[model samples]
Target: MENFVLILLAIVIGYIINRLNIFSKDAPTILNQFAIYISLPAMILLQIPKLSFSIDMIIPIIVAWIVMFISAILILVLSKFFSFSKEITGSLMLVSILTNSSFLGIPIINAYMGESAMPYVLVYDQLGTFIALATYGTFIASYYSNKNKITFKIMTLKVLTFPPFLSLIVALFLIGVEFNPVITKVLSSFASTIVPVALVAVGLQLQLRLPREEIKPFSVALIVKLIIAPLIAFIICKIFAWDNQASIVSIMEAGMAPMITAGAIASMAGLAPRLSTAIVGYGIIISFITTGFLFKIIS
Candidate 1:
C-alpha cells in the first residue's frame, strides 16, 4: 500500500511543481536523463549481480518476451491502419510493448501472491522488461529520433553506448562476485531514485485535455497495454498449462502500466511528448483498478 501511495504522491508532487513553474520546461528531460544515466545503471549494478538464474525462471522469461514481441507487431500494424506518424508510432512502440513490470509489478504481485512469488516477479522483471527497456527502448529512441535513414550499425552503436545497457553487460559479468558493502550501499542509494524520478518526470509532462486527434491513439495504447497484453499472457499460460504462481505473476506483469522509463524515453526522443506522458500518467491510475480485477479473475 505504501509503495502504491508513494508512486501516486510523487506524480502529484511533480504535477504541482509543474503548475508552480518551479522548474524550466527542460525539467522532465533532465529528470529522465538522470534516470537513464545515473539511477538505471546504479539499479542494474545493485540488482543484476545478485540474480542467480534457474530452470524455474524460463517460463516467466519466455512468457514476457512473447507478450512484448506480439504486442510490438500488433502496434505497428495498428499504427499504419490509423495513419499514425513516425513519431507517434515510435512512441506507441515503446510505451505499449515495454511495461511497468518492476516498479508497479513488484508491490502489486507481492500483495496478491505473497513473498514466494517474488522470485518469478524478479525473473520477469530483470530478465524480461529490464532488458527490453535497455535494448528495445534505446532502439526506438534512436530510430525514431533520427531524421536520416538509420542503419543497423547506428542502431547497434546506440544500444551499446546506452548507459543502462552498458551497465547491464558489466553487471552480467559480475554475477556471483559479491560487491563490497560500501559499494552496494552507494549503488542502492542511487538506484532508489529511479521510480520517483521517472514518475515525477511523467507527471511534469502529463496532459489531461487532449486534442481530438490524440484520443484514438491514446485509447488504442491503453487498450493494448493494459488489456490485450495481459490477455495474451493469460492465453499463453493456459496453452502451456502453467497453472502456478509464476504464470500468475507473469500475466499480471503484462497488464502493468506503460513503463515510466519507456514514456520518459519516448518524451525525451521528442516522440509526441504530450501523448506519451498522458498515456503513462493515465495508464498508471487506471491500472490500480484493472490489476485488482485481474488478480481476482486469475486467482
Candidate 2:
C-alpha cells in the first residue's frame, strides 16, 4: 500500500504541477534527458546487476506479449471503422497494444504483490516489454512518419543508444561483479529521482485540450487500455493457472496506463497527439479506482 500510494501521490502532484504551469514545456526536456542519461543508467545499475532470471519468468513474459499482440491486432480491426490515415491508425494501434510496465509498473507491484514480484516484473520490462517497444514501436512511429527506411547505421545507432537497452547491458555486466559501496551510493541517489521526475515530466508535457469529436476515439482507446488490457492479463493468469502472487502481479502490471514514451513517439511519428494524451491521462486516472478495487479483491 505504501508503494501504491506513493506512486499515485506523485502522479497527482504531477497533474497539479501541470495545471499550475510550474515550468514551461522546455524545462522537462532537461529532466527527460537527466532521466535518460543519469537516472535510468543508475536504475539499471541497481536493478539489473542484482537480477537473477528464471524459467518461471517466461510464463508471465509470454502471457504479457500474447496479450499485447492480441490487443494490437484488435486495434487494427477496429481501425477500419475510422477514416484515419495509415500513420495515425498505426500509431493509435501501437499505443493501444502497449502498456507502461516498467517506469510506472514497479511501485505498483511492490505495493500490492510484494518485492518477490520484482524479478518477474524486471524481466518483463527488460526483454518482453522493452523489446516490443523498440522494434514494433519504432516501426510504427517511423513507418507512419515515412521514415521506416533503415540503414545499418540508423538501426545500430538506435539500438545501442537507447537508454533502457544500454541499462540492460550494464545490468548484465553487474550480474557477475561484486557489489560495491560507491556504486550503490551513486545509483541509489540518482535512481531515487526516476519516479518523481518522470511523473512531473508527464505533467510538464501534458496539454489539456482535445477535440470533443474525437471523444469517441479517445474513449475507445481508454477502454482498451484500462479494461480490455487488464482483463486479458487476468484471464491469461487464470488460464495458465498462475499462482496467487504471480497472478496479482500480472494483473497489476498488465493494467498499467499507456506508455508515456508512446506520446513522444506518436508526436514524432505525426500521430494524433490529442488521442495519445487522452489515452495516457485517462488510463492513469482510472487506474486508481480500478487497481485499488482490484488489489482489495485479490487480498
Candidate 3:
C-alpha cells in the first residue's frame, strides 16, 4: 500500500513539474532516453544474472505474443464491420498490440511485488513486447506507410541492437560469474534511478485532453489494451494451469498503457499521429485504474 502511494506521489510530482513548466518540453524525452539506455540496462544487469532459468520464465513472453496475435486478428475482423481507414487500423494495431510494459509495468510490479519480480518483468518486456515491437510492429508500420519494406534482417537488427536486449545477453552470460563489489554497487546506483525517473517521464508525457472525435478511437484502443488483453492473459494462465506470481505479473503487464515508442513509430509511419498520441496519453491515465483493480483482484 505504501509503495502504491509512493508511485502515485512520484507521478503527481512529475505532473506538477510539467504543469509549472519547470522543465523544457524535451525533458521527458531526455529522461526516457536515460531510463532506456542507462538505468534500465543497469537494472537488467543487476537482476537478470540472479534469476534461475526455467520454462516458466518464458510464459510471459508467450502470453505477450498471444495477446499481440489475438489483437491483430480481432482488429482485422472488426475492421470489416467498422469501416476503419488504413491509418486508423494501423494506429489501433500499434496501440493494442504493444504495451508500456517497461516504463509502467516495471514500476507497478516493483511497487506491488518488489524486486524479486524484476526478472519476470524483464522477460515480459524484452523478450515479449520488445521483440513484438521490432518484428510485428515494424511490419505494421511498413504496411501502413507503404514506404520501406520490412525484412527479417531489419527486425532482427532492431532487437539485437537494442541496449537492454544486449544487456540481457551479457547478464545471462555472467550468470555464474562473480562481480567485484565496487562494480556491483555502481550498477545498483544506476538501477535505483529507474522507477522514479521512469514514472516522472510518464507523467511528463501524459496528455488527458483530446479532441472529441479522437475519444472514440482512443477508447476502443484502451479497451483492447487495458481490458481485453489482460482478460486474454488470465484465460491463458487458467488454461495452462500456470498459477504463479510471474503469470500474474504477466497479466498485469498486459493491461499497461499503449507503448509510448509505438506511438512515435506510428507517427513516423504516416499513420494517425494525433490519434496515436492521444491513445498513449489517455491510455496511461486509464491504466492506473485498471492496474489497481487487477492488483486488488489478484491479491
Candidate 4:
C-alpha cells in the first residue's frame, strides 16, 4: 500500500513538474549527468565492497541473459510479423530487454523486499543488464544508426568507464574493508537520496500519446517484459535455482519495466523517437500493474 501510494505521489509530482516547466528543457540532461556521475556512483560504492561473492549470480545472470536474448529473438520475430523499420526494431529491443534496474529498480526492490535486496539487484544489473546494454544493445543501436562502427574493444572500455560500472569495480576491490562512523554516515546520507529523486524523475518524464499502428510494439513489450519475465524468474526460483531472498531478488529485477535510459539513448542515436517514447511511457504504466502483482505473489 505504501509503495503504491508513493508511486501515485511520484506520478502527481511528476505531472506537476511537467506542467510548471520548472525542469526546463535542460533537466533531463542535468538529471542524467547527476545520476551517472554522482548518485549512481555513491549508491554502488555503498553496496559493492561489503560482501563475499555468491555463486547465485550465475542463475540471475542466466535469467537476465535469457531475458535479453529472448528479447532480441522476439524483436526479430516482431520484425517479421509487424514490419517496423530497423531503427524502430532496435529501439524496441533496447527498451524491452534493458529493464529499469537502476533508477526506479533499486527503490522498488528496497521498498518491497528490503535494503538487503540491493546487492542482488546491483550485481544482476552490473553483470547482466548493464553489460548487455553496453555490448549487445550498443551494437544493435549502432548498426541501425549506421553512422560509425564501434568495436567491442571500444565498447568494453566505454562500459568500464561509466561511473556506476567503475564504482562497482572499486567496491569489489574494497570488500572487507571497514568504514569509520563518519564515513558510514556520509555514505548513508548519500545513498538515501537515489530513490526519491528517481521516482520524481520518472514522474517528470512520463507522457501519454496515441500509438502509431495500434502501438502493437508496446503491447508486445508490455506483455513480455512485465508478465513473461516474472513468470520465468518464478520458474527459476521454483526449480530451486534461487531460494528465498535470492528468488525474490531475481523476480524483482526481472519484473522491472523498460529502462528510460533506453529511450534517451534511442533519441540520442537519432533512431525511432516515436517507438522509444511509446516504450518508455507504456512500459511504465504496465510495469506498475505487474510489479505490484509480482510483489504480492513473491511475498
Q: At residue 263, what lDDT does model 2 achieve?
A: 69
- Candidate 4, 138-242: lDDT as tens digits: 887788898769897989898988888888888888878887879777878877766666777777777777467747776777777788777877876787656
Q: How many clashing pairs per prediction, in order?
A: 0, 0, 0, 0
TM-scores of all candidate predictions against the true structure: 0.78, 0.86, 0.94, 0.92
Q: Give the Å error, residue 112, model 1.
A: 6.0
- Residue 122, candidate 1: alpha-carbon lDDT: 61
| Candidate 1 TM-score versus the reference | 0.78
- lDDT string for model 2 (1-299, tens) is 56666776777776777678786757668777787777767776776665555546576677778878878877777777776667558667766767777667776666767656765676677666777777777777777778558455665677787887788787876675767889788878997787777766766665556678777667777777777877888788778777565566667777787887886678666788777776776666667677777667655
Ranking by lDDT: 3, 1, 4, 2
Question: Could you tell me the lDDT of residue 28 within candidate 2?
Answer: 65
Q: Which runs in model 2 stand beyond 4 Å of their true positions? A: 1-5, 81-88, 147-153, 176-178, 244-247, 297-299
Ranking by TM-score: 3, 4, 2, 1
All models: lDDT?
Answer: 0.83, 0.72, 0.87, 0.77
Instruction: Assess candidate 1 and give its lDDT.
Output: 0.83
On residues 8-86, what C-alpha lDDT tens digit does candidate 1 reach at each position? 7877888999999998999988988998789878877776676576645588899999999999999999999999999
Candidate 2, pairs of clashing residues: none
Candidate 4 whole-model C-alpha lDDT, 0 to 1:
0.77
Q: Candidate 1: which pairs clash? A: none
User: Between 1 and 4, whose lDDT is larger?
Assistant: 1
